[model samples]
Target: MASVREIKRHIKSVSNIKKITKTMQMVAGAKMQKTLSALLASRPYAQLAWNLLLNLAPKTERELHPLLQIRGIRNSLLVVITSDRGLCGAFNMNVIGEALRQIKDKETHFLITVGKKGRDFFIRRGYKVIAEFTGLGAPAPFISITPISQIIIDEFIKGNVDEVKLVYSDYVSNVIQRPTTIQLLPFQQEQPEEPFLAQFIYEPSPSEVIENLLVRIIEYKIYAAILESQASEFSARMMAMKNATENAENLIQSLILSYNKARQEGITKELTELSTTKAVIESLKK
Candidate 1:
């Protein structure tokens, strides 16, 4: 049997841990809500960008711009999004794993990472990381995405990478986040299942309008991806903290139970000793 003092100490430690986890859970929940709002706000714009691209694709020649040109894939670049800090269950692992699966040793692959976690993981494994951006503030600003998008665009334009893909965790719901990868370069027209006719008149020239629009579209897509990733990170952290808090509570309860049992045994032993002493005194007096 464990001593009451030892069990009491364990209970106190668990209680402290429970307090910390509960606080973290609350913090993550609040952060998730804020990031979710930004994500929701940006979705319509992102969708509009896609619609604009769809309308523009048929009118313009693919050769008008290098971004729209589909080149043979000899080497590729991957942009991976991961949370800078991890307390989230499998959030970083899932993204990093998906990136790893795409890597071909024989084919040269360059990486552009958006988070410290992903950057560090690939670096430790001796992967070539061409670019990295980290410490994006909470509720990342719109301007913060420009550098990343620019780097990707430059790489494609320079023919440094034949293909560009974004690997991230998609925010499905508060309870569900799925790791997903989407091609970002060699722009494809996302056709709707149902046919819808749309037309546009360019102000200057079709090529010039497309060149500008394509840049905006790429920037918006990267921005949207970052927002989705942030939301997922917060959601995952909230769930992980919640689980930790629950586990701590369970441990505290078990420890308290043990402490009570040990204390009870100690009381019983003391009572028995008292009774035995009393009888001995009475017998000696007689």
Candidate 2:
């Protein structure tokens, strides 16, 4: 049992902690809302781009485009997206875990880490990190992520890596986030439901248009993934801070109860001692 003084000190400490956690929670919530808006706005564009690719896949020859050219998976490049700072529960770990699972059996796999957490995790364990980009800021701009997409595109075109994959946390809702793995290179072709009956003329040339569109699609895909990851990170941090604040409140309440109980016991003991002294003095006087 702690004394009243000790319990009071504990209460004060927990109250201060609660204040900090509450502030953090509010901050995270604001960031999450902003990131979520960006994420939602980008999602439709990403889907449309992908659908256009699917429609174009049947028209283009695999030999004409380097991005559509499929090769043996002898070597791979993984782009892992994580948060620069932690304090979020399992957000970074989940992404790292998914990336590890992806490359568990691969013989040659290089990493392009997008955050400090993933970069440090792989580097400390002797993993090959070919490139690293950190502190890209929350709700990362499309322009900032272009270099990362360009790197993978250049690698694929140069035959340096056969396959390119991305590992990120997808934002589902405020309370739910899911780690996701997606292939970015050697675009997969899916047949559309209806066959092409109408023919359309290319603006300048089919090859040049397809080439540029492929590059833009890759860049947009990477940007969308980063946005999803940013939203998820903010959501996770907000929830974690909320939980911490609640726990601190509960702890402070318990400490206050203990402090009151101890103070009451001390007062009872003092009164008992005073009563005893009065009885002895009265008897002595008689």
lDDT of 2 at 100: 97
CA lDDT of each prediction against the hidden true structure: 0.87, 0.88
Off by over 4 Å in 2: 51-55, 105-107, 193-198
**TM-score list, all predictions:** 0.93, 0.93
lDDT tens digits, residues 5-67, model 2?
A: 888888988899999989999998999898888878887887777666666666678898999
Give stretches of model 1 more than 4 Å off. Answer: 190-201
* Residue 47 lDDT, candidate 2, scale 0-100: 79
Q: Which residue pairs come into collision in candidate 2?
A: none
Error of 2 at 254 (Å): 0.7
Write the residue-wise lDDT of candidate 1 on 154-222 in tens digits: 999999999999999899999899888999998876555445575556889778878999999888878
When summed lDDT is taken over every stretch of 10 residues in candidate 2, the lowest stretch is 50-59
| Native RMSD of candidate 2 (Å) | 1.8
